[model samples]
Target: MTDLFSSVALPGGFEEVEHTADWAYHIWAPDYVHLFLQAARGLYALLGAEWSPEPGTTRRVKLQGVDYESLLIAWLNELLFYRYGENLGFNQIDITHLAPTCLEATLGGSPITQWSKDIKAATYHNLAITPTDDGVEATIVLDV
Candidate 1:
């Protein structure tokens, strides 16, 4: 299994964080778009999810939230819905539009062939997207 806490090649990346219960990671990217994308990838990593070799599938997503934090949670939870409800795992994500309270994206993936963990939801527990020297970062906690 890939180490959940290993450092990833940068520009945009994620690394696991120690949490007493549930799971958590710190994600960062050069901007909101990449930040969102990295978060999706991080979630999949935590699940140890893998996709099928067949032709990929795609979906369009449009979401709105009260703020960036809520929007982030909604975005991740939407992915979780697809995973458990549809048995899908995405490896391609294109965020065409993003704002303080809304997001639009195209997601591409295939049927999930493997998943080692069950993450119930992406929590808002101490969640916040903040600016950094190069981009933005957030600490995401997932309910397992």
Candidate 2:
């Protein structure tokens, strides 16, 4: 599939990491909003997700967590829900509001036409969002 975030110029990015089992990615961005966006893009890439040609669908998402890690997992799992349960894949995401424990965003995409991998859920194994010289970074592990 095409690179979803190719047109946008953003600081930081994500890369797949070696894992004995399951999947993992190291994601970084200049701030929380960009970090979240990168995480979503990474998740979609990992799924090998593809969208239909039909007009895209849009939905609003709201989530809360006790910390950054939980909030990040919640965000990714929410996207997974749309992918598996709703048969949707999003390429466009706009996070309108974000705080230490809450997030609200608008997601845009179309019905999923292809998915090569099955991701059960985002996991907390060794999950931690940390501050970096440029912004923030985290290594996300997924349950396959």
Candidate 3:
């Protein structure tokens, strides 16, 4: 199998794992969450796909967070930022920061022409993150 932390080609472009748990213990999960954010930010920088002010055009994204809901919100917010701020669309998301309460990721491709399906605010969908043997894992629920 391929290395989990190694750089891999994503839907947007490419991504690499900046850090991961080494099967050890830790005090709080937030510290690790920060690492994931940093990594994801790095990836976004590498992609070099800026916000395009087009209609129905998908663009790549790089956003970070400290919790599931926050992470999801951050992801969609970035899309919203592109949409309202620059009139762009968001499509695929490449999540490199896999943490229980944090996330770092890069997204690609959003339509600028197509209007948002619904204008809904971000909400906490009772998100949760948990530690696992392979590092950290969590499922973010977005109230859209």
Error of 2 at 27 (Å): 0.2
lDDT computed for candidate 1: 0.87
For every model shown, what is its TM-score relative to the native structure? 0.91, 0.95, 0.40
RMSD of each: 4.2, 2.4, 12.2
Which one wins on TM-score?
2
List candidate 3 stretches off by more than 4 Å.
1-64, 116-120, 125-144
Candidate 1 per-residue C-alpha lDDT over 24-130 given as tens digits, one digit per residue, 9 for 90 to 100? 99999998877888888899989999778989788999999999889999999999999999999878777888998899988888899999999999999998899
Model 1 lDDT at residue 97: 87
Highest lDDT scorer? 2
Q: Tell me the tens digit of each residue's lDDT in model 3 across 14-40.
A: 123222321111111233444333323
Question: lDDT at 70 for candidate 3?
Answer: 70
Residues 50-133, candidate 2, lDDT per residue (tens digit)?
779999889999999998889999999999999878999888788899998999888989998899999999999988899999
Candidate numbers sorted by lDDT from highest down: 2, 1, 3
Per candidate, the number of residue pairs that clash is 0, 0, 17
With candidate 3 superimposed using the best TM-score fit, by how many Å does residue 60's alpha carbon deviate from the native? Answer: 5.9
Evaluate all candidate structures by whole-model CA lDDT and list the values in order: 0.87, 0.89, 0.41
* Model 2 lDDT, full chain set: 0.89
Clashing pairs in 1: none
